[model samples]
Target chain A: MAVYTDITESELGAFLRDYNIGELLSYKGIAEGTENSNFILHTTGGTFILTLYEKRVDRDDLPFFLGLMDHLAQRDVSCPLPVKRADGEIIGELAGRPAAIITFLEGMWPRRPTTAHCREVGVALAKLHLAGQDFPLQRRNDLSLPGWQRLWDGCRERCDEVEHGLEAEVSDDFAALEAGWPADLPSGVIHADLFPDNVFFLGERLSGLIDFYFACNDFYAYDVATCLNAWCFERDHSFNITKGAALLAGYQSLRPLDAAEVEALPLLCRGSALRFMLTRLYDWLHGPDGAMVQKRDPLEYVRKMRFHRQIISATEYGLQQS
Target chain B: MAVYTDITESELGAFLRDYNIGELLSYKGIAEGTENSNFILHTTGGTFILTLYEKRVDRDDLPFFLGLMDHLAQRDVSCPLPVKRADGEIIGELAGRPAAIITFLEGMWPRRPTTAHCREVGVALAKLHLAGQDFPLQRRNDLSLPGWQRLWDGCRERCDEVEHGLEAEVSDDFAALEAGWPADLPSGVIHADLFPDNVFFLGERLSGLIDFYFACNDFYAYDVATCLNAWCFERDHSFNITKGAALLAGYQSLRPLDAAEVEALPLLCRGSALRFMLTRLYDWLHGPDGAMVQKRDPLEYVRKMRFHRQIISATEYGLQQS
Candidate 1:
């Protein structure tokens, strides 16, 4: 649940004057994104999402996030395009927070994703990577190895509160991930946080991708690795190889992976798992003690990373050998 | 922040099958109402609000809530009429909670209301009261005097945590409220909680009323009293007489206040003020320590109640003596 900032009618009316979109009919604070205050804006023109970027998101990266969406939507990729203001600015300010209005996309994210949904996500993600090739803005993956280490250090003393031996086990996992991190593998603009919640579908067909707040320049295969962790896991923490095969097969249908990219898949998967685990653990220990936001169980990611640790080859994740 | 219940795609799809509303296009969990999970459901037909009643709301009282909206809408009052299922049932079970789909009302609630907005609210609220006159179903205002004392008892020991001498002050206020509480003065179906957030407006016109979860049989003047505390106060705690005058005058345009009701206005305002102050104080002291929902500041209402205590007559609140 979100909407930390409240936008007033007069302020919103003043803000809308800079846009070509018709009169503001209504807008609602949405319980969607965590790092931003999101409102579903309705106007005589049509519906759009008005996002007021919160403090957690860096203001400097606004152009990259908005520009990437605009770039992707222009191509065959299905994504929201940032509505440009009268002065041709994609970003604006509202209630002391940087904001942007993005064209609304019609779809609901698959909550209990089937194999078909996984395949559709693979196809959409690949299309996004292809479309983002010429996006003209750059943002490094902030949740990469170095960032993970910083997060781990911040909560290292209290990390064991989650699991009895979580601290020591994660320390070893950190060392391995750092040593075997992918140096190079088909790098492009990757939706670094391409979780199922960010991918929306109209039934079984992919409609759009959203929450580009975490989109950045990284290994495209690393994006695939994130999805492998997010989409392939069953409720019992068991990996579903059939879904994995469907995802990879769908990805290959659009953009084929090279030899080295496939080989680095398992390590990238470990890195992705570790990345989410460390952040969740840090939040579990240090997040605000209140009833306004629900905390995700860090131990769930601990179970996931543990599962990824046992895998030796990309073939275990249903990727075909070249 | 709201939307506590998570509805799976298959579950929602199955639920929507019972309605002729058309294919589900998109739905986003809204962080609006506190007691229920509200999802903005967009289908091929149009936009609607899907509310899954949380435990805080009584399931048995749902017919009254749903039926009141249906009845009020038929009488030309703007509200979210409950969309019935194929079997003409307004209520259904979804995600283990009692849920219903209501037609979406367009407009935004005024954050910083002006005198014009207050006048518009007065006009619409009277209309709702008039339309609800024949509403057959009856539900008591459980949060009235008795409920206030029960809440006060739960937090009496820790009442001083909010302010020194608070316990004694509130005890006296309670005694006075009980004695002065209106015995009978033109009571009808009242939107027991018609705070600015529950009322919507497009431009200056009051588009509709929402969050009827608190609607019940109570003094119509008491409902006005709730608004007096909710709408007429400035941020610094001083009452705005201009806004109050507009609200009173606009409301009297349709439903003239009886002499008895007018005489009882001050005590009813105090009662309204105390009712909110008690619940908010209880939440402030005993609300969940971890993340899930927000607890409003109780001291603000305490200040408003104090203001009402000093007032001699309704004339002080911009109401002309009848």
Candidate 2:
């Protein structure tokens, strides 16, 4: 629900002059991608996505995010490749914000994730990690352990407005994650936020993954752990072990995790849960109410974090010992 | 910005099974059309618009609206044809709401309409009227004078909050319109709401008119007058004679207005302006403060109605008496 910037026809015609895509036939603000304003563009050439990177996205990270898509598309990973201009520039300016056009990927993100969808996403996740290994640009995961604590500090005083004992429970979880956080085992570009909404599915097959704004250099297992927190949860906050097992099996089919990486899944999952909870908590406490932006409940992640705190092994999450 | 009805994958799949359209490739909630929830659905066959009629639309009016589109499309009016199911039904239930899929029209509604676009819409409006002559359905324009008076009574008390002495000014305007309103002058189907957003264009050529929720039986000249209010006003609320003339000239080229119709243009335009103002005034005083639906400034139409009041002849609006 975002079309913050308005582009006039003459200005848009001038902008499209840089690309080979033919004259604009039609374009509308699409209700997709919360961080940036997205418009589904249909031109004489073909359909493409016009993204105006909003304030939430770092202007400096434009190169890395767009470049990663360009790099990964050259490989076998199915994702939206940034459409380059005549001079080979991928990024351009529109409505005074850093804007770019990417080829429209043809698939819908599943609204309700089945066990099969979880497994397919895991396989695609592993595939993205493998394809991203040789990518040149590197961005450190900012929503890691330290990032979680930093986000928590902003919301600590009023976190209980959302829940009675949420503040203390989250603080203790952060302390445990900081002490036991994994420093090694495997590292590469991971889609740190590979939720189902970011993964497109056409029928039973995986079509592509999107929203590379959160892609960064991070532990591969941590990425998998984020998937556990995101994909394996039921509507009532209970963890679905079948979904967990299927997702892990699908990932392991492509790239087998080492013993250390396997053991760190529980802690990594807990840390990932805390990372999301802290940011959501920040938005929950501060987001402008009644605006078009849908505010997610931070307490959903709180329950998941508590579930991870009790996990003794990856086997509990439907993983077989490697 | 409307997708009030949330459709799941399985539910969507089951719904699509009822139609002959092939497998669903992608479906995205489009931020277009205020009355209904619209999603641009892509399937193996081709792209189409899937609209779920919201509470704003009357359930019984579905047959008339859908039948009008069906009838007009058959008559070469260039409107979206409702896709019928194998059972030959245009309407179906999805997400517990009445839904239907219409053929996707290719073109963008001009954000800043030029005189050329104005002319194109004028020609198209006349063509729609002439084409709709033999259509069986007859829907009274409820949003006409009677509707305006009913709406104004509801908001008359609070209308002053929007403007100083607005109640008196509007009351006087209403009294004048009721006294001078034309009883007959080329009656036919009129698109009661012909705002720029409902009119699509390719370059300066009018691609098609859309959002037929307000389509009903009314004076043809009144519809032309609504266009004058909608398309001929500048952002500053000043009337652009070039636009008004172009639009009226375009309409007359296809179906010439009678001398009486020509004489009634100024009064009809004023009445049209008041109609919109009353509705917008009601919403302005009543719209939820933080709701996503944008409440239009009622003063815009007040200013437009005043401008129309000063006009002496149809020639002043670029119309020549035939």
Candidate 3:
């Protein structure tokens, strides 16, 4: 209930004293987030975001998250660069949580992002995946297919209580997904949560990307699946063919997906949709009582899962013939 | 963190003692939900679901939720029936939370729900609207056109942090929706969340409906919008015209839509999709961070919203000329 991490002006000043960055002039908590507690710090030299790892974030993964920023920044990717300490460590302990300070990149996350936005995002995402090809550290997508089933298994008995036979149907769908899991596609580090909010833009151009929490080594096409599910639709929750076309073209223009990747897109999109649906469904079924978190209607994703379920045929997603 | 409410064997026995209808043989906590704590109770008479209101549920609204069930049941609509307690009250206190017991209908929520299922759901939904014509409660959809802008305003500042210019576009859409808001359409209570998980089926027939938390008085065609968003889509999140046809035909068979309703279908669908996208977008901006509640990719709905945005003409939704 108490403030999990409270860094006063003096405390933050002392915290940054050991860092190579110039004198810290001002710092305050950014109240607009639900995940990590972020403080926008304005120093004599520059501006940066100081994030204190929250409950949802694994402390052990702080290095990976911070190191990823450093790595991506070094690769000329327009992303936040982790400000290292004098000891050369990118992460630090503050307010009893793993913390890091990173130079804030310019540009805003697109609000009314247009089809052109989707296209640029697709291109940028492909480039990010390529840039991550040689990144040192590796983490598996723990919330992938198998992980989803395990979570569902935990909530199976309760499923019937919420809606009669919801458990059985979910089980069947999971089984089907498992049985048809794609094999031997191009694999690499992917920004698995490439939602529009995570991607920043200046004018019509994509400026940078953020939120690497779900970034992991996975099938390259799955990232495209994530994008198609994210960017191709408008505010009304309907599919836009023009946007879909532009996005796919942009992605292909950058990375040029092979025949297998193109073939796997529809299924991958379905899997991506199901992945979120199952997770959201699980959360809907078992979120802790009286928590500050607002629970989303799992039925929304249920509709999405159903939409994806119908995409069994390759032509359903309008994938260009390889 | 410890179990918030523990309904032990003796406690549940005492709780069920006053109910007049059936013999309580067995009761168990149903763990598959994120909203309310549910128990599947098998009595000498029949099976029922005992739902304990959780945090997200407003205790005051228990009457609306429970009464709607009773109202629907009285109208010969297939839905759960709320059981009255010995005190002549439908609502009761359990585990320091508002609670109620309702008859559990037979059938599954449909995992791989087919196009046939979509048609059946459309028909059932139409029947539900017709049956709900004279229901006493006068609740309006809290998430209607204006409600969306209100939510958008609350989260607009942080909107830049997620999707760029979503705030402005949503505002513009709201203006457009308001300028052409439909009036003089047939009015009725609509099951606003008609997703596959909320509809139950026995073999090929729809046996019952659940989750009327979003039911409200609105233009009848809005229900169709909800359905088109829920059904008539393949798993890959693309619209399926064949499925759409079946669903429309089925609904028309139950209660034929008026010309105005048909004319408004595309915008209504767009409105419905935007409603969900905004809700999901708000959640993405300000939802709780936990291992359980996975943030839905807002971009999925974003893509859906965009599709709806492109539908400037009624012909886009395939409405036949009256």
How do the predictions measure up, each by TM-score? Answer: 0.97, 0.97, 0.49
RMSD of 2: 1.7
Q: What digit string (tens of lDDT, one per residue) describes model 1 on residues A4-112?
A: 8888988999999999999999999888877888899999999999999888899999999999888888897888999999999999999999999999999989888
Off by over 4 Å in 1: A288-291, B288-290
The sequence of per-residue lDDT tens digits that candidate 3 reaches over residues A1-322 is 1123556444566688879788765443433234666665656676677888888788777767677777888887888888879999888888677888888665555556688888898788778877887888888887788887787777778877666877777777787778878977999788888876677665577878887877788898888888887777665667777777777878777788887777677778878877776666777788733253346665555556667777755455555554
- How close is chain B to the truth by TM-score, in each candidate? 0.98, 0.97, 0.89
Q: iRMSD (Å) of candidate 1?
A: 1.5
Candidate 2 lands at a TM-score of 0.97
Q: Give each model's whole-structure lDDT.
A: 0.89, 0.88, 0.73
lDDT of 3: 0.73
Taking the tens digit of each residue's C-alpha lDDT, what string does model 2 give over B82-136?
9999799999999989999999998878889999999999999999999999998
Tens digit of per-residue lDDT, candidate 2, span A1-322 = 6666667766777899999999988888887777888898899999999999989889899999999999888897899999999999999999889999999999878888989999998898898899998988889888887777778889999988899987788778877877888778699999899998888988778899999999899999999999999899999899999999999999999998999998899998888888888888888888833266778889898889889989998899999766
- Each predicted complex: what DockQ? 0.77, 0.74, 0.01
- Model 3, B1-322: lDDT tens digits are 1112446444566678778756655443432344566666656676677887777677767777788888888888899999998889998887678888888765556656677888898788888888887778878678897788787777778876777877787677777788877966888888888887678765567889987777788888888888888776666877776777778878888788877777778778878887877777777888733333435666666666777777765445544443
lDDT, candidate 1, at A203: 86
Can you rank all candidates by DockQ, best first? 1, 2, 3
**DockQ score of the complex predicted as candidate 1:** 0.77
